[model samples]
Target: MKSVQKIMPDMRHFEPLPDMDDRQFQQWNALLESRTGSTLPLERKTFLVTNLGMRMREIGCRSYDEYFSMLEGMEGLREWNILVDRITVHETRFFRHPMSLDLVKEYVDSKPHDVDTGKISMQVWSVACSTGEEAYSLAMVVDQAFKKRGDESYFGVTATDISPASLNTGRKGIYSERRIKEMDASLRKEYFTPLSQGEYEINEYLRKRICFARMNVLDIDKEPVGKMDIIYCQNLLIYFERSSRHDIVKNMARHLLPGGLLILGSGELLNLDCPELEKINNLRVLAYRRVKEPNKDQN
Candidate 1:
């Protein structure tokens, strides 16, 4: 009887509250729209509320109402950013998408081998680089490519994100055994060292090549880290509203050097407002190249 009771389900349980009230739903949608230039469906709203509500509990907040109220006050923006950062899924790993890295390798190979010009050197930015996997992967690629080419120095990669906790984890460069299984065997051997049972540490060489920073994409006055050769803003733009998307796109364009490449997530697209960029290939992996000179004829 006791064993059967342990196996059986407990019948007594409280019903969950609906994810959000109509007003709360509207507020969440508005906030999403304002930040990402993207619209949220009712389903997504429910999902965000349910998931984010649970996430708030981790921070000791009992309900979404309190969380929302905290976000609305004067110091709310900072907290809001932190909340978003926490709730936003960082579903990424080393070389999760191989084609993008291949494109980068091609670009680097095509460049002239003149150290003096500095034009031959490359600057790559991995915006929203979660867990440092993407950044480290990039570093390994560039380092190998440069070594193969007999070049003394490799390209630099800057990885940025809004979450301090995520950034800290990324900096540590230690991942569980399951995470490393996704990497190619050669790269796995080359870039990681077994730290302990079911854990690995990123190679020091790869770690030194990439710099991580805390950055919010919405900041208008964001100065370019430097003139960049390739900007990988993958899996990030889908969260923003149309205006915010346009603003961030424009800022990214501004940061890119003439003929530099901008890579976005599969779902993102450039609008007419961004006239300086021309789309390349009608594929989900849409690539944008900055025009050598902005067309004065078109506004």
Candidate 2:
């Protein structure tokens, strides 16, 4: 028999795809809002085109056009969720923006015990709690504060986010060393265990205290969540248009207990026509408090 030599196939080279045009960008933004209830700004549009375009190429798409076409044809919601996750910013760290945490501490400190109901507890909702850092940080602060007061069981934290993947990571309570650097040394030692290579895992005690749920703020029904004492919806409203922001604020106010607090992103504010909320001035950070119920006799 004659010996035959093996043949090899030639690999073709690839090139960077073109950027998305304005029309395609608009379509993508509309699609995103329809799926995630968030509107993309011009800067965010540029970011998605630049970053997610690269991601599309990595996933074997030759161009933005092809990738978008594929996206349009997809039937399931998961694909849309994945696209939103790609473009959504998840920049968060332990104890991020201490001013917000300070406000939370103050609110907790001021809460009064129920004379008739025994020890009164408070509920905190960390809206858009990405990667669990903010929620866990909130839990730690509440836990530590109440522990010092001999009232560790008087508070609970409800952490919610739209991304299931991020929630899963948060629920795991494990983090790389860099993520926890800003955390207090004593806190780190108390709440986390060092794994190999500068990684740490959050203690189950803190993790258990938090209830992480996947939620879309726009579609959330107020009745199921009950009333909350403090709602931290920071850095989330900027992604919404004015009308959507107003709607979200109204819905949030309905869920807030009387005399509860509603914290918006530093860049967000209530509309002048919104009579349900009152802004708290002289604060170093952006904060607001819900107005108390009107006297029944006055009504």
Using lDDT, give the best candidate's number.
2
- For model 2, the superposed segments whose C-alpha errors exceed 4 Å read 1-14, 63-66, 69-74, 221-223, 270-272, 294-299
Error of 1 at 237 (Å): 1.8
lDDT, candidate 2, 1-299, per-residue tens: 99999876422214556767888888888877876778777766778777676566556666666666666644646555676667777888888778888888888787888777767688888989988998898888877777766753467788888888788889999999888887799999999999999889998888878999988897765438977888988778887777888888878877778788887778676553456678878456777787887662132
The number of the candidate with the highest TM-score is 2
Q: After superposition, how far is residue 179 of candidate 1 from its true place, in Å?
A: 1.5
CA RMSD (A), model 1:
5.4
lDDT of 1 by residue, 103-192 (tens): 777777776755565545778899889778888877877777777778655578899987777888889999998988977788789888
In angstroms, give how far residue 122 of model 1 lies from its true place: 1.8
- Model 1: lDDT equals 0.75
TM-score of each: 0.82, 0.86
Candidate 2 achieves a global lDDT of 0.78
